[model samples]
Target: MSNPLPFLKNETPVNWFWVDVSTQNLRVMKAAHETVRYPISTALNGLGERRNSACTPRGWHQVRAKIGAGLPANAILRGRRWTGDCYDASRDPDENGHQDWILGRILWLSGMESGFNRGGYCDTFRRYIYIHG
Candidate 1:
């Protein structure tokens, strides 16, 4: 069977975190290690309290859950299921009218502390959404 922990095998036992917003690129950081960054596209018309769908949330979050762990890279995902096809954003025409596709992997985010990003409107956990490749 394919190893689900593919990303973890290469590095030491360090914690990993990531940040992505509509305006900026995706940033992944591993504790005591170099950070990996990539450009991303967010919601176009701005969604939620963030006001702008393009604006990424600002706060502290943890990977509450990781999905599609062992799936092949670029595998199409919908409703969190693998469609058995690799996806290339640049090559595939946008069928959903959105340029973003959370594929291959998903990081479920949860707020760390209360008030700031925990409860109320700023809750990241309750607003759980998939983040893809």
Candidate 2:
């Protein structure tokens, strides 16, 4: 059996992926393909592992878990809880003053094979940050 996800192909050429925390962008590169880019959110002050703080970690990571497969974009999520509503960027952030919900797509990340990202200093999954559409 094979993995069903588009990004989870086995034997696919090894591609490099990186996220720039400062610019809130994700980039993926394959040998001959153009680098695909996506907008992302990081830690507000770039600190802490608590909920409600939009601080994205700075380091190397892989797409640990890709969720909401075949789901519509802009889906609403609260407390990791999915509400029936789908949201766009135009939506007001004030509605949920705390805790940015993971919607649309979820790439649950585990730290990479090296550096501060591997251990207690900065664990991606433990921080509870999720990327959405």
Candidate 3:
């Protein structure tokens, strides 16, 4: 694994979030030291960089924007905007739960590396990849 620092000096310590897909875990790191960990769910189709692949993209990324700043938890969002609704069991009355819902706060991510997860079809920003509660 390589350390990814964007615009920050190497000697300067900072906090970052590491999403370990294989372990289904997310960890908070301060200067390469783990501070906290949490469980996370990834895509059903696994990992990829193609559009509509229904997979998680790999590589370094930075948060491009934060959405739903003042919204309550489980706030339903569509097209990156709050739909003025919140999630409930009634939302999935059929219990199939096949719908992909973007809820709560969102951290829109943009890939940093070119020709991989950044430019063209691999662009994470255009793909609408996000980290949310």
On TM-score, the leading prediction is: 3
Using lDDT, rank the candidates from best to worst: 3, 1, 2
Local error of candidate 3 at residue 53 (angstroms):
2.1
Candidate 1 local lDDT, 36-83, one digit each (tens): 777766655544433223434555567788889889878877777888
- Put down candidate 2 lDDT per residue, 102-123, tens digits, no spaces: 6677767766534455456567
Q: What is the lDDT of residue 10 in candidate 2?
A: 50
Predicted structure 3, TM vs. truth: 0.82
- The runs of at least 3 residues in candidate 1 whose Cα sits more than 4 Å from the true structure, single-residue gaps closed, are 1-23, 30-33, 42-55, 88-92, 95-98
Clashing residue pairs, backbone N/CA/C < 3 A, model 2: 42-55, 42-56, 43-54, 43-55, 43-56, 44-54, 44-55
Residue 37 Cα positional deviation in candidate 2, in Å, after optimal superposition? 2.3
lDDT of predicted model 3:
0.85
RMSD of 3: 3.3
Candidate 2 lDDT for residue 58:
54
List ranges where model 2 is wrong by over 4 Å: 1-13, 32-34, 47-54, 88-101, 113-115
Residue 101 deviation, candidate 3, in Å?
A: 2.7
User: What lDDT is reached at residue 133 by model 2?
Assistant: 56
Cα TM-score of candidate 1: 0.62
